[model samples]
Target: MNHTTFETPVVSRARTVERLVAGQPTSDGAGVKLTRVLTNTLQRRLDPFLMLDAFGSDNPGDYIAGFPDHPHRGFETITYMIAGRMRHRDSAGHEGLLSNGGVQWMTAGRGVIHSELPEQEEGRMEGFQLWLNLPAKDKMRDPWYRDIPSGEIPEFTRDGVQVRVIAGASHGVPGAVQRDQTEPLYLDLHLEPGARFEQTLDPALNAFVYVYRGGLSIGDTAVPVQRMALLANGGDTQGIVLQAGEQPTRALLIAGRPLNEPIAQYGPFVMNTRDQLMQAVEDFQNGKLA
Candidate 1:
């Protein structure tokens, strides 16, 4: 067995972020079948992070149920396409199609109402939706949009494995979408059978790997497909490493600094206080925002 070592800032286990497991419910609407894996209530509070959902439908009937206009606040939503196409239109007057390897990163700082519809492609539609929370100081800030095409992202190859930098830093490369608050690392990796890769990370930040296309063995644990493996951080002297399995493997590695705060959430709105939640509801009802 060949071993590779990666270097990253070290910290004590006491600073490691907590991990929570959630089997997101399958909801049908707007012609799509969505499995909500993580959400505000289940994640406790947003700390440079919040939720993730996977929507997949090979049958037209399952994916045709699209999402209508919905409101969001105090966070950003990132939509990444792995298969099929998605058309997005938002209250900010932003609209576009996210094809395979495309991404839409939108900041719903104050509020925004948007709708996402599956654009049929060879009768299949599959994608991921991730939610990132902003700090209290930037929760009500101005909104912006980053429509990133696949080719525009940075990538590198190692030992027959290719890695794409979706956010943060890796292999001396960094993602384009910059944030003032949360320093996050989002990556898309593809490894050939028998390949291996390792990356360092901040010991104080929470980190995990989600297997979507293949399986991988981390440390002594074998993480299967469609499952997420939460890594142990903080106080550990050695960084993390991964070894690819028999078949080609594709996975997403994500990590971010922690945000320890009380979370008040209601449906599409997430805030720090209950009063803010009520205010968000009122805003949506009054047509002030959303």
Candidate 2:
């Protein structure tokens, strides 16, 4: 609910881009076209963070079918809708409409069956769905869900840059939600032409930035549109600095405390070991996953 304005933070040693990756073209949710920015391959390196999928399309045919009833366990899903509308229904009896600039945060603690279907027949459906892993002790916790309207999220503007704190604190501004296990930091940055922004981050957290509109620079690395730059981690860097070029740019900056725990994933289910995964599958098959 914070529409406050503030000055940008100072970063003494900004983290540079370790790898520049182009999102892979893929489809999910009953044929919804999207770009998989964070794939399964990087799960280990990212830890607590599992996947980040970006989807945007003007053609209704591309996203109309939406995501059918799907089972998820041992993790959380944060769907940020940039445009259009989608209805969500889950086994836990939670339902909501995610419209433009809204977020649907759901935790499939032990397990849950859900569906995300488009509420529109035409126009654009643009958004990002991020999957975050749970800690071993809390993997089987009860399911939880929350719908966050755009205005409810805490945000601040500094100069020409606007920072939306989705999950963690930014420049003394707390986000809409917080998690103790991962201490995740999710920010949506909107920068005007020639604007510069800076954020302070814990050196121990793993971090990355995905440029969705226009392009920007991180140190010497040029992050173009549709590209994700994995930030280098270490005690050497204090945070990150972002500067927009001639044109306005928008991006998602995400970081999180590493779980450093073993990750066992089998499709929709993510657990601690192979045996646990098998048990999850069995639970789903037996209609007990929810």
Candidate 3:
């Protein structure tokens, strides 16, 4: 008698796009025109993530003034440049210049005052600012900053897909930015026409994809530019799969472990309780935040 060995088929868990969000126009940071992708209206908060803004314009009038003298606390801010340059200076004596393909990761734990201005006078200024929430335990830890140049960022290419890892691992390659609390996954992906990209993620983490250019197929649904695809809870799923349209496509894929704690936020401060929120305000007003 002859016996044959059988192989088990691998099952890929693809998170379904729960909803499609059309970015809304909003002016922030000294008359900067940007599209707000994830905001308070979108489910109060997305666990460890707070907000995402896509800002870009060839016209100088749209983004020249830039963000001057701002205060933040209890969270983190990530600025990734795509087309232009931005200079960041904070009260912690931290200064960074984020040019094309550069990144600035700022953690305003206790408190921080900073300013972000364009490094150029006339040209295209384009970038994305992502707000990541800090857990209550880490909220009052300490302020820190990480400046990553374009040349330092790790980029992985396979077939027709290119992935730039900023805060997590992709294709077994780790990113430059690191956070022990959140353990977030942030990837900038570009795909050629008809290309496909897939990666497994922590099943307990919340994830989403924001399309910035061209179109893509997430699962079976089609997503266009300036739109966000919120993923369902991983549950039994293993990973996410995406396919590009006829044209090239670009997007940001982010995921993080959910804190599952109460959130109290006011302006630039995000705390655990209303009293903490008020304290943050008082600290800033009393010039104690630095």
RMSD, each candidate, Å? 4.4, 1.1, 6.1
Candidate 3's C-alpha runs over 4 A off are 1-11, 43-45
Model 2 per-residue lDDT tens digits across residues 1-290: 76665445779899999999888899987988999999999998888799999999999999989999999999999999999999999999999999998999999999999999999999988999999999999899999999999989898887898888899889889899899979999999999988988899988999999999999999998899999999998867779999898889999999999999999999999999999999999999999966
Going through the candidates in order, what is the number of backbone clashes in each? 14, 0, 0
lDDT of 3 at 171: 67
Q: Give residue 36's lDDT in candidate 3 (0 to 100).
A: 88
lDDT of 1 at 3: 17
lDDT of 1 by residue, 1-290 (tens): 11133223332222222343434657745546777766555464336678888877677777775888899998888888988887889898889888888888999989989888877745768778888888888788887787888878777776777888788877566675766557888888899997877776767666777778778877667878877777766575344566789999998888777777766778788899999999989998999884
Each prediction's whole-model lDDT (CA): 0.75, 0.92, 0.87
TM-score of 3: 0.94
- Stretches off by above 4 angstroms in model 2 are 5-8
Cα displacement (angstroms), candidate 2, residue 73, comes to: 0.4
List, residue by residue over 191-268, the lDDT tens digit for candidate 3.
999998887877788888998889999888898988899888847987789999999999999998888888788989
